[model samples]
Target: MAERRPRREPRGLGWDGREFEVTVGPVAHGGHCVARHEGRVVFVRHSLPGERVVVRVTEDRHPGFCRADAVEVLEASPARVERPCPFSGPGKCGGCDWQHVDVAEQHRLKADVVREQLVRLGRLDAADPVVAGLVVEELPGGALRWRSRARFAVDRDGAPGLRRHRSHDVVVLPDCPITVEPAARAVLGRDWSGAGAVDVAVDSAGVVTTTRLDRRGRPTATRVLRPGADVPEEPAGRAERRAGGRDWEVEGTGFWQVHPAAADALVAAVGEFAQVRPGETVLDLYAGAGLFGGALAPAVGAEGRVVCVEADPGACAAADANLADLPQAEVWQGEVDAEGLGELLAELGSGPDVVVLDPPRAGAGRDVSRLLAGTGARAVVYVACDPASLGRDVAAFAEGGYRLAGVRGFDAFPMTQHVECVALLVSTAR
Candidate 1:
């Protein structure tokens, strides 16, 4: 029998503009391709695998893979499209990368990314089942209300905008399409004579809230929670309830997904997947401002318990006050890890039956997943911003006993590659 031959490596090239036939590597969340040049791994933008291309290295790294910006397209994939958004030009003022690709094809790329990450990094056990995004658009009801919270940097010329896709330079977007005109109006319309940062959020009800130092020089809590919506009885509750909006006040600009409806769908899906009973104890990992725990409290009825673990100080404070009315919920202020979870579980005196993990785009740490796997929890609902990381955590949970029970997609951001996903994993033994 002939011995197995070593796999040929990808052709690696330096900043040379030379052309090469390169297989399009897996598409990453941000629209970069993980390609092999010779043998080393390099991240290239605007370059798809299978179609050979000559690319220019915008960022050069020695001893480490460099980042390249595709300068020439020798071959193009059928999935590629002429990007419609003018903001996505080569200057890179826009944030989205898959705009040049068809919407359905974009989803296929995302699904592929999720699968590859789960297999290679997360150790996922996915096969024929396909994971795709929800049909829901970013702006449902014909209202662009998804961008609930945004921080527009105040430019030197008084223009409010986002930084260029890859550069620190700001783009003067007098009006942003992702946000409603009114919500964006306040940002673009506001006079930034003396302000350094302008924070804005818009509710689904078309109500806009602006938080920042007023021209009067005082910190303000502006809320557009709507006229009929019930305000939380407590002031702290007000922060949590209104925080999930276009202008949802972030705790000092920490990490958060921008889509309100998408987040709601994610949380609602998580609640359903976990199958929270009337008295089951649930652990909310990376619980920012008690959004999931607080929302789950009512869904689980009076007998349930939701222990929220959050590392952000500001978010935890809001979470504590938000769940103040719900005696069944508690916000544990700490990092998410095995030790922290163990101590929290010990305090409960009983293990949780439902687990909801909503980590950052980076996903959850393996230790916490391992610990949760060993517990009495029979099901886990993992919510993720980066499917790459989500797949990784899914693999970890699979190792612990949880099986990929169900998967759903949500279009939190339309006209962009970014989307949200929730995975339901149930214990195999149970």
Candidate 2:
């Protein structure tokens, strides 16, 4: 007689049609692993792939895929560590996913995630170079205090907190471990957000500006002056302190790289690859506070123009204020899509010599890809946050007539499994 399969049982995370005994095990990655009744498909998260656990039904449906949240662990994995945060285990903050797993394992899992995205979403050949990942053991300068900007929601009492992952409900945080030091200090010390956005920036002078606030999804032409870094003459200090490349204040509400040193390293890498020439025109897409613009303007000289494409009015204003001294530098207050870019480029008449794109996590679409391909620019430097997106766009560039020249990586968020990459490409000859 054939061996009998285990009997099926109901669980927490939902299952629509596919029914099987939920087997939990510790997977090689951090999360739990669950085997479905079919035995062919395995669901993984907080359980090891081999260990057994009773999974809660989160969502059920499709033929092969079912969503579940694990509730009970009948068997345990050796790798499991008692999670440190009350917000992470059993309870849910939803902000962090890998806190329960060992820190080293988190890196491995994140690497796998990136690798899978590259193969699955990017559609890269299996033989392509395996991109490596870095883990941040601690935030440099200080792990918990490195973040320079913070975006806090205003509750009714005028206190600030973060919204839930999917919902608008405010999560009142008595303590936020991930936020940078100065910004966190400014946030907790006072009642800043009054139904509006609040930003606290400390300039290089060690003075704090708590008054300038930014409200958009990203900090556009605006500044949030908090009780930190005070600007002498607003953004004008950037010109005055050009020797040290003075720090312009960024309010806690707007967008700025959480990791400052790492961002500097990445931008420096882009600068090195761009090999910008004086008297040449350049374009910065998705320019944030003109980090590229600020860095490249002097290299391009007063004669060269650095056109910035920024959608946020606040950021545009900030860019304008930051680059005010450069007569050749200008800001186009519009999106970086095909038509917008085309119009913005049309104003230049001639094609750009150097095109730098620091797109968000999603990466640029085909229209922008095609324009860069056909623009006849000598070189294009792309700075990307997500590796999968970078690889996809790199492949797209090859299809569009740009030959991939070289690529480099920067371990921006150490201890965390995030990597920042800069890629250089030269427009191929017709």
Candidate 3:
């Protein structure tokens, strides 16, 4: 018998610079809805589900699917709305994917993506009641004026803007409504030749800091513009945030949620899911700026202990200072994978009763899940920014005797495809 050979992918059909009328299908994971034209699958952006639209294929000759943007909405869905931002359309600012979609409808689509990923990638059956009806709750004012952070791409002309979808060409943005007060006003309608990109972080106090990066993405300058102050060309460090009844000092370039309400909402969700009690050991892995640490420490009480492990030295340093008030909380300034959870657990001299996993966009890999399972934590809360990654990790956790007990998604990121999820997992062996 002849050995079976690997199937070869079909050669892509050229459809670039072409226009076609197509009916949009259900929302896919990447903020685009699926559609087909002449037996070829096309990923249509700037379109809503069930909308009949004319799409201009921007990319073809790709291995699996072609990319296109809605050139015209011939028949719009009831969920469609005039995009609030003029920069959000075909070939325009790629920063926002669903500006054309209604805010409520956007949450529905995101929830659909979450459910789909859990079913498909996580190998959870649709018949499983737990995986069937996922809902994405919107943070207070999630739709507009919620983004506390935005990084503007700089073009050759020195204008700070967003890049066009699938292109490096920057779209000059004059105004963006989704961003909170000063950062939006400071960044939009600005030009800077000194940097390839600019990072704008607005703290909880509404203080704006802009970091100018050179063409190589190195920070050349940092400046702070207090609220009501004129937008400075350069920016400086540390913005203070009050969350979980404590102050958090996060650096300008440090990792924090983009939405203004994300910190509070996530902290609440994590706290509720963790169910940490007095005198219980808690672990916060990939602890950025110790946001979860702040909440866990108080919940665990002085008798209990909270350990935060973070890799970014700058963020770790900031975490050290942020968690200083809570003597029960300890910060480990090293990689979670490199330091190894086993070593940390041994050093701490006990297993955690509750664990919070907030890894990067890539998600905590299988090795991390295995280690987490070995930790013997009764409860684990996982915070994720990407559904696909979360779904993959969910399966990994399953393999390690952890079952997804509950999941809640939040529209922390409004206009973009990104969604935040807080999942509760319980150890089956326990």
Candidate 4:
């Protein structure tokens, strides 16, 4: 006999599916606007600030706050516009949060979120010049078709698409407007009946590569398509990317910036803030493909040293290969944890003069932040994809005597709530 499936217990007094009118308030982190109905707070998506909309509660697991989508707009903000992507909207594709917002307004909203997160979580004063003067700069590409790399979820029937908002259900799509046309077509145009998802990327050379992953999220196969080629060629072990005035070798579908221009912009920002001088030592933690280390190696010169640390062996190998010509730069494969970082620092014999860390979305934890700050590095340039994570880590660094000196925001992921930030922190003791 077949095993019986467990039944889900209903949530009592829940607001799920309940509809109510709300006046949207300020933009909040995580791609939503805050609004209050009665005494409960609602995080409404697909709506702009200062707009009156009828929101449908999609989730109400928490007693104090619930997640909602604005189903009907009674009064629209000037920033509201027709969504460029037909796949976007309430209960539709959850990939983009600001599709309904104007492109310029989208940048402002992201800047607001970054500032708010820093002030609230980093314990920074709102009046601080760095916090008050923050702005989200736009990338070269327009709002649409800027995603150089993307992952499309494959449903059981084999259609590839993105997941719905906070849901496991896949919304099948013919194309994703925000994704590069070549990438979107490469994955969505094909049916992966057995694969759980497909990751596709278009490199700077116009080469398209697709990786098929099983339901367990393990890579099953990888195929490459050169420009103007009808069929995919044998799997190319690495993809070529040009950034920071150099070419980089990265694993296909690796952690390169989704925005084509993001790497160069970040490199410039990091370099300006780090201001590494000759004979200085620099540490690039979570260094993928040695992008920052290799870029800064010339500035440090042969008398200086640059160490690129990464946890992933694949990325480490790529970094090593990328920096082989730069004698001043070396790639060290290790986790950037508190304990590991401590050991690495001890082996260096001297603290780094400049530290550039491009941590993942979760950011370097408090322990890592404190450990890095203890190094007495003159400058710590942090590249963060999540503002809240950056804010929390900044707070931790403060405890170790570092002060946030400067910060710049980038709209690397347009049409989405995600924003990339480059921050500079200097030792207060200096």
Best by TM-score: 4
Model 4, range 126-224, lDDT digits (tens) per residue? 999999999999999899999999989999999999999999999999999999999998988578999999999999999999999999999999999
> Against the correct fold, how does model 3 do in TM-score?
0.94
In model 1, the runs with Cα more than 4 Å from the true position are 1-26, 34-42, 47-54, 62-65, 71-82, 125-145, 154-158, 189-197, 210-257, 313-325
Per-residue lDDT of model 3, residues 1-430, tens digit only: 9999998755567678899899999999987999998887899999998999999988886667898999999999999888888778888788889998888998899999999999888878876767776789988875878888888888888888888887888888887778886887877777797679988888888788888889998988888888777645454568888776778899975688888778889999998899889999999999989999878888788899999999888899899998889999999987777347768878987788999999999999888888888888999999999999999989988888898888899999888899999999899997
Score each candidate by Cα lDDT.
0.66, 0.61, 0.87, 0.95
The TM-score between candidate 2 and the true structure equals 0.71
Number of clashing pairs per prediction, in order = 20, 64, 5, 0
Q: How far is each candidate from the true structure, as Cα RMSD in Å?
A: 8.2, 8.6, 3.7, 3.2
**lDDT winner:** 4
Model 1 scores worst on lDDT over the 10 consecutive residues at 232-241
lDDT of 1 by residue, 232-351 (tens): 111222322243321233443234456755556666677777767788888888988777777777656778888999998888886776688889998889988778778888888988
Return the candidate ranking by TM-score, descending: 4, 3, 1, 2
User: Could you estimate the TM-score for every candidate?
Assistant: 0.76, 0.71, 0.94, 0.97
Report residue 96 deviation for candidate 3 (angstroms). Answer: 0.9
**Residue 69, model 2, lDDT:** 51
Clashing pairs for predicted structure model 4, backbone only = none
